[model samples]
Target: MKKLSFTTPTAQKIYNDYFNRVSRCTRTLPEDDQREIMMEVNSHIYEATLAATPQTEVDILVDALESFGAPEVVLQALVADKKVKQATRTFNPRHVIQALYLNISNGVGFVLFGVIYLLIVAFGTLIVFKLIYPQHTGLFIREGHSFAFGFISELPGGLTELLGNWFIPVVAVLMVVFYFLNTLLFRLLKRK
Candidate 1:
């Protein structure tokens, strides 16, 4: 896209600095993605400047950038979205973690997803506990109603440990289910 020329040096500097900040925000993304984002921002600025009422170049540029908002704040969602797309495509844990961190503040859905992921990790760690403390690590049921999934410090008379040898498999299967459920939820969120 052709760069916009301003009547004053200050306006030009303002425009350049804005683009520089945008470039910084998008640097981690792929080149094509970066260019696409830059182009989109440039187009918005151009259109804003054109549609703006007659005014000083500095005033017009300032208004446009202000309305567009600080690049760091406004472009956060876009960067997070692109990161998520890349993460999903690559299926890399590092990328996925980055994507999640970027999107963590989006809403309750991301928060819930994060908590669910931590639970899955905790469940995975339970297998180690099962090995180290076999007696206290199984699914325990008290009064055949109250149940717990992890290590129990004390076994009361009413509490019975069930799924003795099957605890590891049960936790593993549960983790898989939770993982898929989170994936489904993440896809739904990405669509939004």
Candidate 2:
């Protein structure tokens, strides 16, 4: 029920535009849910811009909105979250499909994260093969326009040979970092 007042006209206008987008995105949601999300975002914008000098107010507000990500992205995340909760509470096919669609679409970084994780695992396996073979260069080949991995006799060369010994440690570090990132992403999704 309270209002947010910005001293600068430009800052206020920016907030209005961003809030309008947020409102449009939340239209399909329940009134209470819509109100809750708006309140949280509104408070965040105020907190973010309150510390900024007048000259920096618009920039700070824009950055704050950007940090929340695109309006559609936030809506997808919220929809996915709601659908998950709804699915658990009921057996509606519509809810399940909605959740599935949102999740497969723009909801979370699930597919992208999963693909990256799988690639990391594959590369990690290749590194292990290199370590075990030691004598052989292994097989990761570039065939004119493409790449393949195996004992294909006369191929370009293995990733192990191309990358040398450093590949293993690098992949190991990447695996750890990606795992951490995936965890952080889930936490953010859960908060939504």
Candidate 3:
């Protein structure tokens, strides 16, 4: 990438420091991704500086950087986007978790996705609990109506264990359903 030239030392220092911050912000990405982001940001700043006919290098550069905003704030979307692409490509849980953390606040879709994931985890837990305490873990009925569906230490007088040995399979099917919902939501709500 071509370096921007500034007559004033302060302006030069500012430019260098800004790029340093950009490098830090993009450090977690792949090398090629890092270079692409750096180049794009450099291009924007350079264009902004060139378009303005300011009195001095410092003035022009300062205006450009100010319009560009701070690296951490401005580059978050770009970083989050690349992280999502990487996570999708790799199918790595760690990357997905990091991507979720980065973009969780951007929209309500991620929050819904998180809820579905939690439901899947809960179903998995139910399967384990059913194995550990078969008699106590299952759908419970009370007074001829469905009441609760989970493990309980003491069964109420009118409560009855409904699923029995079918609890594990039911929970497994629920896990699959939640997993599918999560997948569908991600596919629909993910940024292009």
Highest lDDT: give the candidate number: 1
Q: What lDDT score is found at residue 8 in candidate 3?
A: 87
Estimate, for each residue in 76-163, the C-alpha lDDT of model 2 and write its tens digit.
6775676656643452546534544566765446566446546656767767666776434343435444544423334335333444
Q: Candidate 3 clashing pairs? A: none
Supply the TM-score for candidate 1: 0.67
Error of 3 at 163 (Å): 2.2
What TM-score does model 3 achieve against the real structure? 0.71
User: Model 3, 24-129: lDDT tens per residue?
Assistant: 9988777899999999999999899889985688888989999999999989999988987786677566777777888798789988877787777788988888
Model 1 ranges off by over 4 Å: 1-20, 39-68, 104-108, 153-158
lDDT per residue, candidate 1, 1-192, as tens digits?
Answer: 677888799999999999999999998777899999999999999999999999999999999999999999999989999999987777576777888899988999888888888888899888998999998898889886998879877767887888989889999999999999988888888888
TM-scores for all candidates: the values are 0.67, 0.45, 0.71
> Model 1 — which ten-residue stretch has the worst lDDT?
87-96
| CA error at residue 104 for candidate 3, angstroms | 3.1
